[model samples]
Target: MKKTINWKFTLILLTVGFMTAVQYNSMKNPKERDTRDIWAVRHELAVEKQLHSELLSEIRELDKTIFTYKSLNDENTGKALTETVDKLYSQAGMTNIQGTGIIIKVKPSAESEAFGIPVTDVSPDLLTRFVNEINRFKGLILEIDGKRFTTLSSIRDINGITTVNGLNVSTPPVSMKIISPSFKDSEKLYSYLAASTIHDDFYIDNLILEVGKPERFVEIHGSPEMFENQFLKELPKGE
Candidate 1:
């Protein structure tokens, strides 16, 4: 009777252990699957972005060709040719963009926890300071959190949160894309940020800077038309 009782207890223990392992495996498998799905989504998004950039470039080239033909014929409307080109480039976020640029990624500091410091959230002041620093180096075409910076775009602090171009920065590792016509132009921005990484600008805010190499292609996306804020002013009278 004692031997039978012991054998039954051992069997039950084995069964419970096996069930627990299966449950753990089941939970882990879904997490892995979710990770794969997330990666796939990111890959799709990048591909679509590249396609859109190509299409925009082609459209701009066609428009330039048409404008050039008008100018060669000395058309009156050609007088605004230069102005129109500038407007198109501004709208496309490609003004004076002769070459590629660097992408600076700012992430939450990893060692903050180890040092018993908590500064996980990115502050508006940090974003503004970063923008100012890059601009100081003549970094053209500044974009933060995928929102291209225009003359009207700004970083604002509201209710203890940071908003860039009126959008909340709810994620870690904010990306800043900067384009310059000269490699040296982008390089200056890159070098400044690289050197600043070791400075207190990042340490005080608990941030990590990752300045990527000069990419061959960098297309900063503009805001949608819905985001346009119309300023009220009297229009200039047409002659």
Candidate 2:
């Protein structure tokens, strides 16, 4: 019992310390932007929105855990701590998810194929914008080309090839799986994505965005990489 209590307390302290470091960094290093194009500004806004949403979600989760810890008896403390840890892992994209959601397929447009026009690679900017829009509805777990999309994941172009989570996905016929909180939400997301202008955005690039119908069973794999506190060091002990 003593060991269990010590472990849980240590875990909570470590989590709090990490979050404090993140908060300090955010306060210390504010983002600066120069005169840029509309697309750049839009992308920045989207990224900010996504970060804000994630922070709020995590805050809620932590608050719930704190309440649980305060009220939990010794008999149930272990079980509650285990459940909280599992939930945190799932939210961090460390666990595969099977739930209600939809699949989206991206490929070359028929017109491009028929006209023999070379299909361009997926634009990293455009893909990021689309992800931002998808996040607006919330309750989403996304995976692209079998790579899970986590908060730390990066979608960028290296030598003209787009990569998500450091894996190449610039080619056509890319598959994206999204797991939603419920079937109803998945259906709504399908309808929303189907009507989104992102489809037109892809069409302009000779690519197609096909949003699939809602499914009760959708699989989203976990992220392969783990989050690390690369920059943070242990704080000096209090006097």
Candidate 3:
């Protein structure tokens, strides 16, 4: 019993000392630590939104051109043209199908504030895991903070600010919209994430994930820039 008590006492000292050293290091390099300017991040996001609008304008022009081509084409060519249009819309996220889906909102937990943990921002790693998990469950469409998710979507520390597809999602209580192919898939996602406290330890310990009820007729917009930015031509068959 005496030996066990000594071991516990020594472990406590080592743990306290390690935490104190960490605190000292943080104080030594305060600027090197968390110091992202929210204003700059917001301005950059506005620029991105303007860019998306420009791309949307160009897509509208192309749609008009395609419509004219369809009008003059033979029946088979017209069918192919229609198919191409549908494919582009699907990739661009303009599909207006009625579907059941879920919205997940994340915020810093009360525990984090109580313990003085700086977790007001949702880190890029946590966002990435959320995206990957939703995709794994066959998520048909996704959006973060009103910014559509595409093949080019990414969550990263941009200019010291965590951003999702050029928009700052670092702010707490950001919502992630998940549109599943079916109602069942939406439920699966909720169950998986709900039961994954251990897996999402970093997020759960520092933040709160609020899962919402599945709803129908949820709308998801696709990125117009997805097609506007694509120019690589496919090689002809057997060329």
Clashing pairs in 2: none
The ten-residue window of minimal lDDT in model 1 covers: 90-99
Best by lDDT: 2
Q: Cα RMSD (Å) per model?
A: 21.9, 17.7, 20.9
Order candidates by lDDT, high to low. 2, 3, 1
Q: What's model 3's lDDT at 14?
A: 100
lDDT of 2: 0.88
lDDT, candidate 1, equals 0.72
lDDT score for residue 6 of model 3: 100
Model 3 pairs whose backbones collide? 92-222, 93-222
Better of 1 and 3 by TM-score: 3
Per-candidate local distance difference test: 0.72, 0.88, 0.73
**How many backbone overlaps does candidate 2 show?**
0
Q: Name the candidate that leads on TM-score.
A: 2
Per-model tally of clashing residue pairs: 0, 0, 2
